[model samples]
Target: MLLTKVVALSLSFASVWAAPSPPPQSSEVLEVENAFTASKTAPKFKSLKASAAIEVYWHVVSKNSSVAGGNILDSQIAAQITILNEAYSTTGLSFSLAGVDRVVNATWFNKVTDGTREQTEMKRALRKGGAYDLNVYSSGFVEDPRRLLGYATWPWDYAANPQNDGVVIHSGTVPGGDNAPYNLGHTLTHEAGHWVGLLHTFQGGCNGAGDQVADTPPEARPAFGCEVGRDTCTADRLPDPVHNFMDYSDDSCMTEFTAGQAARLTAAIATYRTQ
Candidate 1:
């Protein structure tokens, strides 16, 4: 889930946190997301009847032994799955780690930005399982001047681009890691939301059909830090959802997904990911 604007934050560790580039929000993508909103009819995908268990294939792409270079430990990866399960507890979707593979490649580790040749090659070589299985690549985006945290592909894009259907995260953002404010493992949670079928909480920016969810109030922009009671869209009755995982808020600031979001997740999983 890439944001439109790049937010440059100077942290105590002197690490700069910049937003990732935007995913393609074309009409087809919008239609796929909005389809759940239009009708409550269950999708043809069979595995999404009540609850769906997604198999996660973890791929660690590193330059060397350094964790900063993307060689994250198995414990950190397990901690991330725990965080994701807690965050998505109410969504009726759960993730199980199917396998973990580590690839030591300096070129792939440093150059795996969104839509780049390096990213394509890396995913094609490392991606595992079918559309239902989640392939998570922990890699470095050092080549990008903005230092993107992570990005994900939509479920609708899987048919045409099966190899690209997965999530790429900055290895430093895992739990007990160096990237502060984002190290609590919420980056994967946020990107996983996109990987399923969620638009940003601030998708339409106070315009029509914001995030296409009925429960979440319209948000004018992404919230950076924990700005409690901050209301950007004054016309709306509720304050900004800075605590939502889908926003640009820090890991500590993110909390829960709304009921509408849960419904959307179920619908999206049924509609796209299921067989």
Candidate 2:
């Protein structure tokens, strides 16, 4: 079961916005969220939920003068916080940068993935705080750079993996950085959605519950570039959610999240993470 899921993850876009680079394999076997810690399987979230203001603490692991690997600028971290807040501005939820800490370690800088003992140990040593605050770990890479941009734990996972309950991101994906197409910082937005219990808009393909949000159209698969009118589910009246933040379109292409999504995400946060 793990192999089947992880292999499919290799094919899906990997990250919060999980639009990993195209693979030689087929899209049918695909996944969006990367395995950033001990989680190798996709999580299923069904109930519609809503949100509240969230405080975020930034835990930056780098190889600078500190104790891990390379470092990111304070300015860069602030900018990402700004972008994150902007993404949730309309959802009745707000994200503020509560604090910032940097640890210098080369081993952690280069590699961390889902299902790895190293990842678990790393998170255990570095993770701080509880469900009341969002813990974000920024590094140079996660799992396979060619396939994953980042991965985050769902709201409920915090209970089982409190130390691992946060989003792991590729440092290059920050805004104003060089990670093109995904450089705008929406990756955090996408991951934040998952952190609040959102599934990919294309999850379960063109059929079934279709991401469990009534407003979001069922997408057959992750859309690559932004094609405005692309429709993969001809049998369904709703077009593919190519532009949703949950889809794998380019950062520039991602525009909105449905009202239903906002409600469900809010509810999830409330259910899992108490104030």
Candidate 3:
């Protein structure tokens, strides 16, 4: 069953991932597939009836160029930790970002000269760290799906071998300005959704099948302009909630999880055991 599902899924995404350009070009939702589908060998945690008390060790790997001043890195780390808590709180999941606990040692100290190259190297190094089962390595690859978070790779934490369960938020997406929601919790939430086994509600394209999860409404594509109530899949009364955490909505407008989504996500997490 898993093999057939994977094969069918691969064919479904063959065109999207193969494209050199970013996804959602024409209401087409370009997203990571096989993110939730895990192999039997991987650890699966029984569903937590409620929020499970877990300590998440966070190691922020930053480049010298990124930290213009000493405080910038501190501020960014603080901000990210807060957001992660917010998402967890929403779902009754609890975690703490252990400061500088396990830094995935990297050779590159200078600014990421090449966004693509930096992300690639970062993933490789993360895979080496056996600390956490998953690592969210956010640096320069947030905009492009080809880079994983930015055209890089899936499960950003390669070191842990957690597969496509990790994520990255590009440095360019510091929470602020007009696209804060699209920036801050966007990638993390999306990737975290993958961590919990949720797929892009719109599936691969805006018009057709993407994620198999039911409660999540289908989106025409990744909506960034903050068009609330925009429905790509009209089969139902409520248009696809593109702005929902599962959908690609702008920063501020994106909020709330459907009851169905909440239930599914909670169930998915129950299937995985801590690394």
Candidate 4:
């Protein structure tokens, strides 16, 4: 059994727009009602429900970090695991991953000191192994949660590389940790949004529909730098939902997922992850 949180995870994308575009900038004040508008038509969630039980096999790689021991990595992994389990529980899906199945073991391997060949090969090996598992079960979706390959390791940019369906996480960047892992859980939530197919509300560079989900408002860029509220994108008069998990906001403050996004992710997993 799993406990359901009172607040729903706010995930959304634009459905009307097809092509990617830049987001418009604004300085208008947004109201909650306008910020959140019910979609005329909602995407279906059958596909997500149909997604098969996903088994994550993490390939733990080491990089230059101040933290000693595996505690930092372990902590990062734990945080993601918690969020993933929570998401699966809501959809009545089972999620499990082999604990750090592989290790890069190159904590001391300085980029300048060591040749790139070994590291490149290491990443290739990880991908190959993950692909093998995807083929083994003929799973529709295969994901590598650890920060292997070339992806962001900090907590601020919660971006996922969709090409490989791989998730990169830096333990030091998560919130509560020192300077690196700031607002990490939120970052995980955001990247996980990408993991399932959600995009940034600001889109790329704040001009186009960041994710293309209708329920989520289009913003010029992420908010939070200014202590006071600011609206980057205002269609009518409502401010953007910069605080949404899909956006780059503080970890503790970000939350909420629109019904449409839930439907989209649910359908995505079911279509791709189904065994």
Point to the candidate with the largest TM-score: 1
Write candidate 1's Cα lDDT for 72-142 as tens digits.
99999999999998998877778989999999999998888776799889988989889899999998888
Candidate 4 similarity to native, TM-score:
0.58
Model 4 root-mean-square deviation:
11.7
182-244 in candidate 3: lDDT tens per residue? Answer: 456445555455545555555554444555556666665555546777776666666766556
Q: What is candidate 4's CA lDDT for residue 267?
A: 47
The C-alpha RMSD in Å for every predicted model, in order, reads 5.5, 6.9, 7.3, 11.7
Taken over the whole model, the C-alpha lDDT of each candidate is 0.76, 0.65, 0.44, 0.39
After superposing candidate 4 on the true structure, give the runs of residues whose Cα lies further than 4 Å from its correct spot: 1-47, 63-76, 87-94, 102-104, 107-120, 128-164, 174-184, 204-210, 225-229, 270-274
C-alpha TM-score for every candidate: 0.88, 0.80, 0.63, 0.58
Residue 134 of model 1 has an lDDT of 90
Clash counts for the predictions, in order: 0, 22, 27, 37
- Candidates arranged by lDDT, highest first: 1, 2, 3, 4
lDDT of 2 by residue, 99-164 (tens): 888877767776776556656777888777778678787776644544456677766556765776
Question: Model 1, poorest ten-residue lDDT window?
Answer: 7-16
Please identify which of the two predictions, 3 or 4, would achieve the higher lDDT against the true structure.
3
